[model samples]
Target: MPESWFVPTIAAPRRPIGRQVFDFDRQIVVMAIVNRTPDSFFDGGRTYGLESAVAAALAAAEAGAGWVDIGGVPFSPDTPDVAVADEIERVVPVVEAVTAVSDVVVSVDTWRADVAAACLAAGASVVNDTSGLRDPELAAVVAVSEATLVITHSRAEPHVHLRAPRYDDVVTEVRAFLAERIEHAVGLGVPESRIVIDPGHDLNKNTLHSLDLTRRFAEIAALGLPTLAAVSNKDFVGEATGLAKPDRLAPSIAAAAVCALAGARILRMHDVAASVAAATMIECILGFREPAFLAHNV
Candidate 1:
């Protein structure tokens, strides 16, 4: 590996999110995704029920996930709007159930302020907003609660699509957007230590743009905050490897490893166990973790 590939890891910091402290300088955190939306692009209603969503989150925690991100709606364009009440109903129960039983950090993936406030009251500690804070009130909610805010970079509204999104430089633009959003959130009384950034792979960008962001992910990591990479079973992974969503696990793991090596502290993944293994291997290679029972050639 080139020396440049490891530069960003040197700047990773210890970030305290909610009740857990993530030492990004020495470990990688896997954030399992559990969408409660019936129209989720990945699961397609598999865990939409309250029981199923909670079960899936617990399973992910058991599988070595440090965090579980529960969402009530998909960001795909043309998906029907889920009313704020309905969205809260869909996600809050899962958050309440998971946090009541497990030590895993629970995050609600919504951009609406009301839903975020409800989830925080339900015991969730992080707000994973993928809309780039289109609703500024969400920042105030996070600030008032003193929970972690994941500011993801996306160019479109929640249910609206941007046709043919273009960026002069994807990584640079993403870094600038995240920096601005971090400042915006901090201005609203959100502590700077409680903010995370995501480049929003495939959220509004095409495969080429997403790939570029992944290739240059270290630039985003260098922003000196805990960076998140949500590259699990996304359209960019599918398009890059010419595989359908169901068949993209290997490529998704590959992408996760790449991002981990490039200084992504948090990986939001659907396949919890497999992604955990990949993250562990990267940690061992980077000298941040010791191999478990290394007897093969010891």
Candidate 2:
């Protein structure tokens, strides 16, 4: 039987993003992915155009996502290096358009400090640096803007494929990597209240490694900051179930439930509705959330 886990109290104060503040202690946030890159692995650039991207953001907000993460660059190592100007062009408009229409917290997914700054100026509230702080300038930007910073764990440098990355113990290595990055961000003036950690499932890990991280996620959350599980249609899910990307929603949600049970506070998801349902049900089971109508009992 899977061990029943409890949601540990996150004593950190609410993180402010633009005009929005997230109290991870009380809320299990669903951050919907709104990828504007034409080559993003999952979406295949379906929302690459400005209008399509804006519409996608609105749709995610309406579908019950508390946060929307807009990414202009594909994180896949095969993706070409997008110029800072090109990234700014792709992301800032979406951020501005989304922020203008919805009150949802907006996070810009980029490792470049200039692009992050441009997005923040355009109304984004968080910088999701999936490169694990490859550039310290990204941290400085977040510090100066007083915005939220998502420090992810990735062994390879940005846009560089690491062939067959191995670890003695994946969870321990990931935990240590995230800890070091978090400390580095704080030392660079990013506050603890504004920090979030991600194990970067499938970023550099194999399927088994990702499974280990999911099983031992509480160790990552033990850092006392909200941890994000980006388990939406990732390769690990496909590898685990022998399913393709288009057919991995159910398994993805199942993995997300495990992460939630292990005390993950934020879910970075592609399928917003399903992930919201899974996280909500897990929260209710853990007594972190209450049922809305109570029809069956009442």
Residue 277's C-alpha lDDT in candidate 1? 90
Instruction: Tell me the TM-score of each prediction against the true structure.
Output: 0.96, 0.96
Cα lDDT listed for each candidate: 0.89, 0.88
The deviation in Å at residue 29 for candidate 1 is 0.7
Candidate 1's residue-wise lDDT over 1-298, tens digit each?
Answer: 6554663643437766767888988889999999998999988999998889999999999999999999998888768988999999899899999989898999999999999999999999999999999888999898888699999999887889798998999889988999998898888888878888899999889999988888888888888888899999998898889899999999999888888888898999989999989899898899898888768866
Model 2 C-alpha lDDT versus the unseen true structure: 0.88
Candidate 1 Cα misplacement greater than 4 A, ranges? 2-4, 7-12
76, model 1: CA deviation in Å? 0.5
Tens digit per residue, CA lDDT, model 2, 13-66: 476666777777777889999999889899799999999999999998898898
| lDDT measured at residue 287 in model 1 versus the true structure, 0 to 100 | 89
Q: After superposition, how far is residue 71 of candidate 2 from its true place, in Å?
A: 0.7
